[model samples]
Target: MADDSNTEYLLDASLSDADAMAYVPDPVEVPYPDLEYVSTPETADTYDKYFYFHREDVSFEEALADIRDCDSLARGLNSGMGYQDVYSPYGGLAGAAGGVIGNAIAAAIFGSAEKRRIRRVNLRRCMNFKGYERYGLEKDLWQRFNFEEGFSGEAEHIRQGAIIQQAKVASGPKPATEELGR
Candidate 1:
């Protein structure tokens, strides 16, 4: 039987000059496609553009109905009761007299004011629903490319540019571009 309990291992740490200068593959460069710039027409600046959308005229009856609806809602908010007469605590007859007088005064003054307020509210609601409110023009423009008949390409370009410019301005200042050689 052979005793193989004291085996030792050795490592080589020497390399030739040719082995030291081993070959390394060169990095390949990728070519990118050139971007082509198109000049916008001068007429784009001169053209008058307006965002137009289809809006039906509201009739007197429609306005009246809206006013009535608002008034009814107001009445509901006021404890489901119409205007109540003011009461005096001195006497029943005096209270009745005061109530009558107060009701007359309110009808004469506040009645018209209340009606006007309701009408205004109704008008605003109607305009909002019919897409006639403020900023509606811009909203209509962005909604679809369905421009009016005989609209020129130059006008469209100008309008789109204006919208883009407005959006950029609203978005605040952008980060500065970095220089190649600093």
Candidate 2:
């Protein structure tokens, strides 16, 4: 009789005992210079004298909130969500059917919306870039805005007041001489 006893079989040649996972190299982190390392004398002079002249009037958070509010408003307006037809149905149909004339009329109606959107987008980007440069906050504008409550002028004032109060507390009381003049 043929040997019926089961013999141990070798593993498939393609399957190795060792781990077959591909090597993954570690991620390389590029170093970014700190503000002091990057700032030139001229840039510092301009920033302090010109750009930040009104820094005390508005805190970073307030400015950021205002930027957010403006951005939100711009987005809402640009979305054309609430637009209503001003023209009668007949006029609308005529305008739509007028070929090149219709196209011109449509452009005239919507061109301002496009312009406003572009302006708002640019303004938001500028604010974000400026905030990053001034504060050394690693987050981009949208990321920073995510941490704040929804924008409101009243809320912004309250926040600014709180910030000012904190600053006063952190700095401690002014001397009698310093207070005497004010």
Candidate 3:
């Protein structure tokens, strides 16, 4: 029902790397064992629901712009329960009650957790289409950079921004750590 295209968000002025860094929070690391990474070609697996977009050729600023574009696309797809044209055939008080009931039904069917999950899916799909890989992370590490679309608080938005800004900059595997038995 939506355009669902990559060319939706246009960038006029390019941002410098230093400018992009301002949006990211402090660094975070997800050590091995607890940190399992996967790339979702279809969609994320149940436990590996968290993800960020990465591409080899893009600059950090370009990646940031793409992230914002995908976020916008995701938001457009999940703009929440607004079945505005749902008017009842009945008149007066009965019609008002029926409208309320209809709206509630729509919310139940399309709002909440499922919508948020779809938002994430749509975001990943967008990034995938734009030649980016979807790198999945375990929840704790994912939380450092992402927020559920429908449930984002101020902190979550900041975290989302953090990931958007950091995705390309932190693009590859972390450096090796000393083995436990070593």
Q: Pick the TM-score winner.
A: 3
Output the lDDT of residue 60, model 1. Answer: 29
The list of candidate 3 runs beyond 4 A from truth reads: 1-44, 76-80, 84-92, 95-99, 105-110, 151-160, 165-170, 174-182
Model 3 clashing residue pairs (backbone): none
Each model's lDDT comes to 0.31, 0.31, 0.52
- lDDT, candidate 2, 1-182, per-residue tens: 11221111111234332211111111121111111224445544433121110123444345434444443444323423223345445665664455546555665666555644454444445444543222222222112112222121223222233222222222222212111000
**How much lDDT does candidate 2 score?**
0.31
How do all models score by TM-score? 0.29, 0.24, 0.54
> In model 1, where is the ten-residue run with the lowest total lDDT?
3-12
Instruction: Report the lDDT tens digits of candidate 1 across residue range 1-87.
Output: 121211111111132323322211111111111112222344223122312112235332343233334323432121112357665
C-alpha root-mean-square deviation, each candidate: 32.9, 21.9, 11.2
Clashes of each: 0, 0, 0
Residues 56-134, model 3: lDDT tens digits = 6675556666776776677635546766655667778888878888887877766767678777778777877777765
- Assess candidate 3 and give its lDDT: 0.52
Error in Å for residue 36 of model 2: 18
Model 1 TM-score relative to the real fold: 0.29
- Runs with alpha carbons beyond 4 Å of true place in candidate 2: 1-55, 78-96, 99-101, 108-114, 117-182
